[model samples]
Target: METTLHHLHRPLGSTGLNVSPLGLGTVKLGRDQGVKYPNGFRIPDDSQARQLLALARGLGINLIDTAPAYGVSEQRLGPLLQGQRDHWVVVSKVGEEFIDGRSHFDFSPAHTRLSVERSLKRLKTDRIELVLVHSDGRDLEILQHSGVYEALAELKREGKILGYGLSGKTVEGGLLALEHGDCAMVTYNLNEQAERPVLDYAQAHGKGILVKKALASGHVCLKSDEDPVRLSFELLFGHPGVGAAIVGTINPQHLSDNVRTAAAVLSQQQ
Candidate 1:
């Protein structure tokens, strides 16, 4: 399918960051935790991954989201975008640690600071466009923690991070972060409409809303005749507050199909 790139540029809240409506999720590109479903998805080599990244750029996808906990995702993505780094907006998360092949949450101020520095080295970027606190299901306590927020604010001052946000599963967790953070990547799929209230709040506050798992983590099985995948992308793109949507895929053809589907959906909406 011939893809038009215009459908990819979407406003990222009030931050003035123009990003693709469909973003590349790097969770699976890093490690396989045997979590099932999307978990255990193949991890692409640097060459193939870079080719995909370049394809995203060609299709006008400028926002790339990753987390330090995503195994070697940052390590792979950082160097891959070395030449075209400035052309894209890179986002990463903190508050999670990987030790002895295990993932753990540490939202303390010390850990937050350490995480940012480590992510910078891994991403090979002097300053990240956006940094989010990878909430480990502790939204309330983490928001109240002076150290974590203060550390992020400090990073903003030092120019290491342009802004910070939060990523969580629950609406309450996301709302709590928005009380102190600038952006949010939340799960707001068609089947899970409980997050509409949070989405409205974020829109009112001029905060960016990046939707994750827009396909309901593959729960909404697509129909062979109706193209359920395209419909899902349409639903996500039609959401008024959603600034971006992250869809995980390693197949080049699938990625191109996503871009094509997004173009057709957005065109219909417009």
Candidate 2:
């Protein structure tokens, strides 16, 4: 029998959103350029993408992460998720766009509002459950000078987004995001724990923390003989504020393995 994660869903802090511990990242579903993965991959076709989504759902994953910076991910998901909108907690991003094989960022309030609106149309959804600012390594500048957070907050008040936050790159940025927003997407894995202070703050303040690159962007298990995936999960769930880990795998077997590893680690925590 296959292990399922439905029983392990947890609250996303005070956002009133419950997400599975493992979220299926859809970057590979739209773009394959300039990614940091160890191995190169071909973008999956519609049939393959649909099967992948079904597989993820079967494994009890409800959180789906995407972004405009991920090429046509939002556009593809709009059509692909035709009838299953409510079944998943869709997380998309603003402030960054992948164009001409490069990344562009706009954190102004006007761009933020436009980006969220465009994402809604692209994803063919009434509202995105959570929208994050796709940071461009200028986390502090963006948070301070840019009115992006205020824009997202307005959208939340308008019911266009349930919650808003930042996919930040620094510990300070992550901490600031949780203070003014509902969650923070930080890089936390076996290899990098630099943003751990942000996780601690979230746990103390009742804010949500979503981990990105949980497996070090496919660079796991270099020094130890232990299972790399399991070690990654152990490090993640051991943290008190980590709500979910977004793993970007297009392969079915890898997805199943990830879910199983996460389930095992979480069960041990219980």
Taking the tens digit of each residue's C-alpha lDDT, what string does model 1 give over 1-270?
A: 578565558778776678888888877788777334533456788888988888887887788889888888888887887878898888899888665678789888788888899889988889998888887777767777646778898998899998888887677878877767778888876677777777888878888888888877666654346776787877777777788888777778877888888888887888
Q: Give the TM-score of candidate 1.
A: 0.92
The candidate that achieves the highest TM-score relative to the unseen native structure: 2
Provide TM-scores for the models. Answer: 0.92, 0.98
| Candidate 2 pairs with clashing backbones | none
Off by over 4 Å in 1: 38-40, 222-225
Q: State in Å the error of residue 163, model 2.
A: 0.3
Residue 87 of model 2 has an lDDT of 96
Clashes in predicted model 1: 0
The local distance difference test score of model 2 is: 0.93
> Residue by residue across 75-129, what tens digits does model 2's lDDT show?
9999999999999999999999899999988999999999999999999999999
What C-alpha root-mean-square deviation, in Å, does candidate 2 show against the real structure? Answer: 0.9
